[model samples]
Target: MESSSNFTPFLLFLSATLTVLSSVSANSEGDALYALKRSFSDPDNVLQSWDPTLVSPCTWFHVTCNQNNRVTRLDLGNSNLSGHLVPELEKLEHLQYLELYKNNIQGVIPPELGNLKNLVSLDLYNNNISGIIPPSLGNLKNLVFLRLNDNRLTGPIPKELVGPPNLKVVDVSNNDLCGTIPTTGPFEHIPLNNFENNPRLEGPELLGLVPYATNCS
Candidate 1:
């Protein structure tokens, strides 16, 4: 058998290869974040630390990462940010908390957000976001807190939202939403006040009495 010393060169090469791969993964995540930074109008420079030159976005403020340097939480709430969210946000495969509440963020919520299977809390309240709530959000089975209240959103709440078994709190009040409020599954425990202020929203969905989609248009 060959001496152990013969493996030294092979081991060194393997180590270098791994280092390069780790750098590449970090850069990919950094790129996705930079895309978000570019899309926002940060007058307060809250995203100044989100430099693409860095090896990883973990160094950026408002971003939290795991032991493996994968992004998990983004706390940019109340940062005085405007502009819409980017679809590239779906690239954060390990992301859990996405807090962008109390901002001036406009435009529709990206449907790509539904791809974050590990997500738990998604707070986008008090923004100017409009458009129908994406049905794709039902894909997040791990979700718990979902607050989209105080926006300009229209259309019925997607029925697929009931799929998340861990969902505890959901607020969609103060919006332009129509359709009967869902009463099954996770929506059973939701407070009536949470569903208040929606002038067009019909009361709880009565089973077998009328279609839930009635006059929802």
Candidate 2:
């Protein structure tokens, strides 16, 4: 009987430990997002609700959480936000959709974003963002929609971006990108016009065909 009573205490201790760990994870996500908030110039106070002291970032506006209280979506599209993105965003392990389109954000896409394995959609279209498309983005196996149009981005579209299994929509048009468009994996189905408007971009690569100016200057 005494052994069984001791097992009860152990169960209670384990439960408390788990609760503490859960709180830590939640706080970490909040801290990462707050860091980004400090970096941006929000003209409309869209991020006013992002108070870190709350129980979890799940309560913050423009943020969405899963049933497990982990951040999964960050929808801040068209809020007129300007400022460079922060690599701290990579800490949102459960993040899926990161939408910040139609803003004036300027900077290179963070290579650290490649660590977001659960990412689904990465939309940054109609912005002034510039810099090479990070090859690290290819690591997001679940990525689907990739919109980076109307930006000043330069360099070859990373061949890695074409390999994500779930990629269905790719819009890098109207950018300064060069090099041959990929023609394999999910790339085979992406429309040709999506590659248009960029004067330096070369021919749409077919299977085994050489890419247009693979090495962009």
Measured over all alpha carbons after superposition, the RMSD of each candidate to the real structure, in angstroms, is: 1.8, 1.3
Candidate-wise lDDT, in order: 0.93, 0.91
lDDT of 1 by residue, 27-91 (tens): 88899999999999999999999989999999999999998898999999999999999999998
> Where does the lowest 10-residue lDDT sum fall in candidate 2?
206-215
TM-scores for all predictions: 0.93, 0.95
- Model 2 gets an lDDT of 0.91
RMSD of 2: 1.3
lDDT of 1: 0.93
Superposed by TM-score, candidate 1 places the C-alpha of residue 141 at a distance from the truth, in angstroms, of: 0.8
Model 1 — which ten-residue stretch has the worst lDDT?
207-216
- Candidate 2 off by > 4 Å: none
